[model samples]
Target chain A: MTRLLGLDPGLRFTGWGVIDAIGNRLRHVADGVIATDGELPVPDRLRVLHDALVGLFSTYAPEEAAVEETYVNRNGSSTLKLGYARGVALLAPALHDIPVSEYGAMAVKRAVVGTGAATKEQVEMMVRRLLPGAVIRRADASDALAVAICHAHHRTSALKVATGTRMA
Target chain B: MTRLLGLDPGLRFTGWGVIDAIGNRLRHVADGVIATDGELPVPDRLRVLHDALVGLFSTYAPEEAAVEETYVNRNGSSTLKLGYARGVALLAPALHDIPVSEYGAMAVKRAVVGTGAATKEQVEMMVRRLLPGAVIRRADASDALAVAICHAHHRTSALKVATGTRMA
Candidate 1:
């Protein structure tokens, strides 16, 4: 069973999730947030994120990694901060030599909730139903879990087609 | 007479231009490309960009800073590299405590060439006309100068409105 990890990056908080896949079925493993408070400088915050991701990678040993692609923000400073956050997130996976995939927000939402324009609340609700017995506490955590689940769903379908197995 | 410095960043090269604002007149000071060979790693490339920008800042002592906003690519890896290039560019002005502004591609084209959808050649032609004696050696250098000229035009109009002065 291959495991996948998902990340949702932000300046102050980075959410991560891990899941194990067996054919089309996914088993949620763990999910949490690595948050840095405002007292730290940007580089220090990035360092903290790097350390947290290193710990998570060691703990979970996920086979693959994924992140949500970033977009432009009207606030230039905020966009710059987001870029820093993304750099740390990408660096962590690259250090482990894992292939990291990125999905747009719309793609993640569509894969999780069956609608490209699904609201965050709807996604969280669908994540709760889809990941049964998994106690999802944070919204960011749930979103991260949804991203991993989506990738697993996609890969499973692709594998079935490649193997000439008709998936219903 | 405040001077604005504009930068267009890339992994292998960073282009910069300086333009002075004298009342309603804009005068080009200097423009050049800091070229680095492709042998360096990403971190070294960033350090080279940072140091070159510091040298430029000290020499020009620009009153304001502006940069071209990053463009997203469909390829995730390409987008990531562009983000890194932009990060180094943003760090340069922020380190000097200069208030930096970012112009989107369309905004830059409009400010430089009188139309939002103006072609690159049109923008380059307008930049040459505005700075008749500039020694532009590369297209990227010209683009950087165009960004500077665009900001000059943008600020000139804003200054006129703020001071209730008539345009000549």
Candidate 2:
């Protein structure tokens, strides 16, 4: 079994989830958001995020890490703000020497819900169903789980292909 | 004497400068760029930035920190890229328990060059004059010194005003 971590980052709230991938099966471990005060200065807020992410990494010690790839938002300033949180999210796992992967929204939705254009509600519902008793606390957490599921599926497929090639 | 660290952040190169603020006078200490390879993954790139910032903090032990305020670029993706570096630059000092301040380009220019609309060359020239014997290795380093100079001037002015108020 390999433990995997998924992160969906935002300036106000960063959603994180951990799961154990046992071959083709997945078992949910935990999921939650790391929130920061908006009134605090940007650096202070980022420090909060950095600490929370490090805490989670030490707590779970996941073998692999995945994060949602950012899309350019319409508002330039907001995109920059999101970038700050995303940077911390990406850096935290790498700082711990865990390999990190990025998945786009479409890939995550398709992996979890079997559709690239899955709605928010659909993705949330599928995550709960796939994980079986996963108490997804928020939209961000649900999205994070979706990312983990996607990474699990991709890794499993690669393993299967490698084994088949060896046998042939 | 108060030690200050100033940062000018970019994805490819982050410029940093250290200075000693002695009452109303300023003395240059050091300046350089932290460069990262473009071929590496974003997470790896961020890890490099995070580690470098921490290394600098430990080396300088600056009592105060300042970073340049970002301007949203015309290209959204580039803005996000810069955001990642800026976030690291801002968070590094705060994580070290150093108070971080931000100054806009206009403020930095005015503090160093006596004009808000001063050109880059003018800012570089003024920074060199204000902090004698400073060897700026790059444009980015020059800009970082400008930020440090700006912070020193503002802090000195504030201190003077406080003293004046107490006397009154």
Candidate 3:
């Protein structure tokens, strides 16, 4: 079984979910958000995010990690804030020597819900169906699960291709 | 004397400078850049930057840290890229429990060169004169030193204010 950690990073709230993937099967392990206070300075806020992520890594010990590749937002400042949190999300996993992969939002949706334009509800519903008893409440956590599922699918397909090549 | 570390963060090369501030006097301690490979994935690159910074914090053991408050870049992608590196720059010191300060470019120029409109050469010349042998070669290291100087000035003034308050 391959343990995976998925992260959806934001300055205000960074949502995360963990799952285990063995071949095509995925099992929900955990999901939640790491929130930082708005009143704190950016450095302090980033430290909060960083510390929480490091804690999660130690608790779950996920073998691999996945993060959603954010699209360019129209608002420059918000995008920059997101970038700060996303940096921690990516860095925390790499710091622990876990390989990190990124998936676009579209790819995550297609992998989880069978469509690129699936609504949040659709994604959440499928997240439940695929990983039974996944107690995802927030949109951010559900989205994180979606990305983890996407990684699982991609990794499984890559493994298949490798095996096929070896056989050939 | 208070030891200070100042950082000017970039994805390609993060410039760092260390200085010691004693009342109105400043002494340059060390200066260098941390460069990451462009071909590496962002997470791995961030790890390289993070590791270099962690090493600096241990070596310098700075009591306080300062980072330049950057103006927004017009290009969206570039701004986001900068945000990622800046995040690490700010977080590293904070993680090490160092008090981190920020100064605008104008404030740094004013403190270092006695004018907000000081040219780059003027700032570099003043940094050398103020520190009395700061061997600054790169523009990035000079800017980092300038911010460190600005922090020294501000911190000195703040100390004076606190002293006055206590005396009163």
Candidate 4:
């Protein structure tokens, strides 16, 4: 069994989800959002996000991690701020010696909902069906869960290929 | 006497300089650049930068720090990458509980060369004059040193004002 953590990073809200994967079976463990105070200075806000992730790593103790790659926006300033948060999200897992995998949004959507152009609602519905009774609090948290599910699916397929099993 | 560290953050090169400030006198201690491997993955590169800064903080143990504020670029992707480095730079000092101050490029140039519009060569010349016999390694390192000198000057002026002494 391998435990995985998925992160959807943003400047104001960083969502995280944890799951355990064994072959094709997956179980949701936990999920939540790390919200930083926007009124604080950029550095202080980044620190807040970093410390929160550090705390989460201590509590969850995932063996591996995955992150949704950022999509650069048209607004340069906004993209820059998002990158700052993404840096913290990536760094925390790495500091814990957890190997991280990144998946683009289209890849994640296809993996989770079987469609690269799936809408947000479609992804959320799939997540709910995949992990029954998961109380996803916010869209960010749900997005994080979707990323975790995607990783679980990808890892399972890779394992099958490595073992000379039929590609599922 | 106060020990200060200054940083010029970039995705490819992060420059750092340490100095000791006593009243109106400033002396350079050390300066170097943390150059990340561009070929590596983004998260791995960010981890490399973060670890380097943490090592510097441990080695120098500066009481305070200053960083050149990031100027957003027209290219969103480039600006985002720069933000990742800046995030690491800012987080390191704050993680050490060292107070961090930010200065715009114009402010730093004005402080070091008495002109906000000073050219790069002019700033370099002033840094060489201020720290005589100092071996400047790279442009990034010199820029970091210039920021340190700027902070030292500003701090001294602030101290004098706080003590009710005439501004120098």
Candidate 5:
């Protein structure tokens, strides 16, 4: 079983999820949020996120890591904060030489629910339907799990082409 | 006297230069290097740079800040490191609400010596001529001064246009 870890990085909170991938089947393993205290300095808060991610990687030992692609917006400060959060998130898996795959939010939703315009709630519904028994508590965590499942499905298709085998 | 502090941020060394902008003249005030022992963890090194920059900002009380724009190459890791260093540099001035400006390397050189392709030695020579009494110990510091001088020249031109006044 190949386990995949997905991350959604934010300045206030970082969402993470793990999924067990066996052939074309993906099973939800764990998902949660890592929240840092708002009172701490930005750099210190970033350090907290970094340490927490390192702990997660050690506990789960996922084979592949995935992160949501960041986009630039009108507010320069907000964009900068996102960049800092991304830096900390990338550090976790890069330190252990795990290859990271990036996915856009729309692509994740489309892969899991078969619709590019699927809402967050719709995607969450599909994730629950597919997993059946996942203890998903937060919408953010469910989105992360969906992202992981998307990567697993995509990776399976890629492996088939590399092996010169056609999918049935 | 309006003083502009210039910064050249790097992973191993952070170079800083201060210049007094008086009318049409740019007089160099001080310059130095705050180098980290590269062996230290990146976060610890970033902390050192942050502290040093804060101390410099308070001591000099610069009215504005000018930073060199980052260059992207084929190596993704190098680009990421540059972005991290740039983030630390930007955060320092933002704490004091000082207006920050970014100048490309070629533009800095062109503003100082009338040629974008000028060598580092040529730029240093012009910087010494522009401020005869200033001491320049590091090449990085000199480069930073050139950027400050560039911003000074740009602001003077912009101010002239805003006021609709002709220069002597």
Candidate 6:
């Protein structure tokens, strides 16, 4: 079984989900959002995010990780702040020596819900169906779970290709 | 005397300069650039930058820090990448519990060279003059020194105001 951590990075709230993948089965391990105070300075906010992630990594010890890649936003400042949060997300896993893979948001939606243009509600519904009793409390956490499930599928397929085995 | 670290962040190269601020004198302690390999994946590149910065923080043990605030670039992607580097730069100091200050590019230039619109070459020349006998290296490092100098001036004035004293 491969334990994976998935992150949906944002400046104010970074959502994370952990799952254990065994063959084609994925079981939810945990999920939560690390929220930083908007009133804090940017450096302090980043510190809060980074420290929370470091604690999470120490607790979960996930073998591998995945992140949802950020797209350009209309607001330049917002995009830059998102990039800052993404940097912390990527850095945390790397610091733990966990290899990370990134999937575009559209790709994550497509893999989880079979459509690139799936709405948040559609994706959330599919995530609940895929991970029964997941108790997803927030949209950001749901998105993170979707990313984990998507990576689980991708990794399984890659494994099948490497072993020259047909999908069971 | 306050030991200050200043940073100029970029995706490929993060420049850092250390200086000791004593009364009205500024003495250079160290300056260098941390370069990340361009061919590496984004996560790995971030890891490289983060680890290098952690090491610098351990070595220098600066009491305070200043960073050049990133300006939005014409290219959104480029600006995002720069934010990633800036995030790491800001994070390292915060991790060390160092008080951080931000200076705009123009503000730093004005503080160091008496002109907000001073050219890079002019800033570099002034940095060399300010820290005579210092082997000024890359343009990025020079810019970092300028940021340090800028912070030193601002801090001194603020200290004077708080203490109700004239400039020494």
Which candidate leads in TM-score? 2
lDDT of 3 by residue, B1-168 (tens): 999998888889888899999778888999988999999999999999999999998898999999998677777888788889988888898899888998888999999989999998999888888887777778888888888889999999999999999999
Q: What are the models' TM-scores?
A: 0.55, 0.98, 0.96, 0.94, 0.57, 0.96
Q: How would the candidate models be sorted by DockQ, starting from the highest? A: 2, 6, 4, 3, 5, 1
- TM-score, chain A, candidate 3: 0.97
Q: Mind giving the per-residue lDDT tens digits that candidate 3 earns over A1-168? A: 999999988889988999999767889999998889999999999999999999999999999999998887777787788778888788999899999999999999999989999998898899999989888888888888889999999999999999999999
How large an RMSD does model 3 have? 1.3
lDDT of 2 at A67: 90
Backbone clashes in model 2: 0
| Residue B159, candidate 4: alpha-carbon lDDT | 77
- In model 3, the Cα lDDT at residue B44 comes to 92
Docking class of 4: medium
The collision pairs in model 3 are: none
Worst 10 residues of 4 chain B by lDDT: B159-168
Computed on alpha carbons, the lDDT of every model, listed in order, comes to 0.79, 0.92, 0.90, 0.89, 0.80, 0.89
Q: Which candidate achieves the best DockQ against the true structure? A: 2
| DockQ of model 3, rounded to 2 decimals | 0.73
* Per-model DockQ against the true two-chain complex: 0.07, 0.85, 0.73, 0.74, 0.07, 0.74
- On lDDT, the candidate that comes out on top is 2
Record all residue pairs in model 2 with backbone atoms less than 3 Å apart, i.e. clashing. none
Q: Candidate 5 residues A1-168, lDDT tens each? A: 899998988778888999999888878889999887889656556666777888888999998988877655545555656666765676567666677788887888888899889988899999898777898998778877888888887898799887775544
| lDDT, residue B138, candidate 5 | 88
| Winner by TM-score between candidate 6 and candidate 1 | 6
